[model samples]
Target: MAKKDKADKKGGKKDKAARKKDAEREVVNGVFAPLVTQTARSLRTLLSRDLADCGLYAGQDGVIQALAGEDGLTPGALAQKLGVKAPTMTRTIGRMEAQGFVERRADTLDHRLTKVFLTDGGRASLERIAAAAEACEREALHGLSGKEVKTLLRLLLTVEENLQSAIGKR
Candidate 1:
């Protein structure tokens, strides 16, 4: 009976050790999500400060950049491209219009469709916006080597694609 009791004690210890190891492994594996979230928050804060100097907000930069790529996009198209809702895009466009950065006009051929175009002031801000984004990226990648930066970008893209696929599944 004593021998049986000793065997049970040894088995219990092994079980506890195995459980501890699994917990540690899970903690290590779980760090990816939090780290990515924290990094995104930090990057947004940095970019926001830089963007503020250009007389723009964090999200406003994306709108400007998208317009620069292809001018005269509809608010709905902008919303879809920016991954925002229509109302949010409308408010953003209204604020930009008020700021003299963008203007809305009816499409010539299809007057019913409203198109957003960059105003003269918005076109002038392009350089400053580019500089601000460059500065933000520079600060974010200060220590990393070129290769490391490329690898990080690749991994992030892969992760993003995986997440997008998962979202589509749901």
Candidate 2:
């Protein structure tokens, strides 16, 4: 009777949760996912903690933020800024419209385009979302000073740009 390899043993699909946990460990245990996952989940947790009562989900808050920044943007333009496709942005915007957070008007200049606007309720939500997001950032970057935070942000952005450049070449 030979012992089974840990990888093979773990590979057996016991249940969704078990499989998910295993996969997470593989991807996240060491450094890559730990940092990313912690950063992401913490943000979500903090945002939810501060914002769930206000009825904003992670993605929806983003849409609200975008609308608040620019009062009248086409769904296509919103999609580009949010890094999503037009179809996806359309769906998100539709939901927001239903929720009374946004209003869409047909573009007078371009009837084919629908412009998105934040309502009064939507503007208030933006304030909440911004506060929640900032709270999460403060929580996540607990030790860094102002200058350290600035330097870290610059370095992280540079890394993101370099990664994008490499990806583009490939």
Candidate 3:
């Protein structure tokens, strides 16, 4: 009976240690996800302010840059390139068209299809957009060394890939 009581005590200690480790892991995971999310939100807010000076929004810059690279792309293609849904792309295009930044045209080859083209205003804003993005990046990386920046980028890419893989599995 004495030996059995000692064994139970040892097992309880192991269980307590395991629970402590699990709680630590949970705390780390909880902090990590919120930190990443808050960082992203803060960066977007900063970038949005900079972009506002250039008469653009946070997301509109991506569309402008994409259209600058490929002059005419369908809304569906743009959605795929930007990793957004088709409806969202369509609404963005509509807003941009209203703002005179982009215009939709019937595809020359396929009349049934519509392609989005950057307007003269959009073309002219490209330089300011680039400058805004650069400023945002500089502010974000203000205190980080090049090595630190590279490591951060690598780690973020790994995290993104892991999340994407999990999403794909789902």
Point to the candidate with the largest TM-score: 1
lDDT of each: 0.93, 0.83, 0.94
What is the Cα-based TM-score of model 2? 0.72
Worst 10 residues of 2 by lDDT: 1-10
Q: What is candidate 3's CA lDDT for residue 55?
A: 79
Per-candidate TM vs. native?
0.83, 0.72, 0.82
Question: What's the lDDT for residue 134 in model 3?
Answer: 88
Which segments of model 2 are wrong by more than 4 Å? 1-30
Query: What is the Å distance of residue 104 in model 1 from its true position?
Result: 0.2
The local lDDT score (0 to 100) that residue 72 gets in candidate 3 is: 97
Q: Identify the leading candidate in terms of lDDT.
A: 3
Shift in Å, residue 159, candidate 1: 0.5
For model 1, the local distance difference test gives 0.93
TM-score comparison, 1 vs 3, better candidate = 1
Predicted candidate 3 versus true structure: per-residue lDDT over 17-128, tens digit per residue:
9999999998897699899999999988998998898778779999999999998999999999999999999999999999999999999999999999999999999999
Ordering by TM-score: 1, 3, 2
Expressed as tens digits, the lDDT of each residue in 1-170 for candidate 1 is 99999999999999999999999989879798999999999989988998788789769888988999999999999999999999999999999999999999999999999999999899888898888878889999999999999999999999999999999999
| Residue 154 alpha-carbon offset, candidate 2, angstroms | 2.6
lDDT for model 3, please. Answer: 0.94
